[model samples]
Target: MASRTFSEEDLSCPVCCDIFNNPVLLDCTHSICESCLQKVWRTNRARQCPVCRKRNSRDKYPLNLVLKNLCETFQQEIGQRERYCGLHISEFKLFCKDDNQLACLMCQDTRLHKNHNFSPINVAALKLKEELKIKLQPLQKKLDTLKLKDPMMELPNI
Candidate 1:
């Protein structure tokens, strides 16, 4: 028997066109994101199923934990996969300056990104990470000072 392969579309919420977050199962046996259902309820002022238009007996939509778990797993896998170059089938290790996007070596040589100035993606990422650490240093110092002064003090919003 051949195993079936599923795409991100299969796990996406029809209303949001994104991976389901806080998915809920309707009485009509349809699953949708909980936030999408809330939007419909708020706009239409009715407890109707978004997919089937069936009048729901209860106002509250129970969380579809099984679907929610599947969506989360799918999203994580997608995030990891997105870092790879789709055309070159290689890891995106270069950042094209003209395009302001990451690309693989083969992608950089392609007509689309040819003649574009490039830098190592890892170097750019490391520089950005270091900058972020430097920027957060003041906040960390303030937090430490606040902790030493008063353990129960309310923090002032910067």
Candidate 2:
């Protein structure tokens, strides 16, 4: 069986759209950042879930320990891989498509990428944006075709 790779976006909170910070699971089984939930509760003054709008009978939300740990690990990994090169300690301005890795000026001059295809990070980002747009087009059309029969209808399990 092939293993699935997960990105930070997959673990992000729906409310803040950031990697889960002190994640809490609601009665509706939706996970959200604790601070975001608190802010919602404070503003709404209700136990209603933000995503599903399901009312919670209990005030206390259980901490999603597994998700919290995963988010922490993800954040640490991202922090370790910031703009700087791992070996050269210089800013990464180029992305090597051959190795699917970011490279700094020093790293790009090395033999590892001598024959490899390289693009500036900004240009690579534009290409990725276009690719994402092409991928999302079909999904967007499918979403447009969907129609709701009832306002209170429960969402399907993810």
lDDT of 1 at 124: 77
lDDT of each: 0.82, 0.85
Candidate 2, overall lDDT? Answer: 0.85
Per-model TM-score, in order, reads 0.61, 0.51
**Residue by residue across 35-70, what tens digits does model 2's lDDT show?**
998888887766788889888777778899999988
Q: In every candidate, how many clashes are there?
A: 0, 0
Show pairs that collide, candidate 1.
none
Kindly list the per-residue Cα lDDT of model 1 for residues 38-154, writing each as its tens digit.
887787766877667888877777899988888777767767878888887788999887887899989977899868898899887887799999999999999899888885566
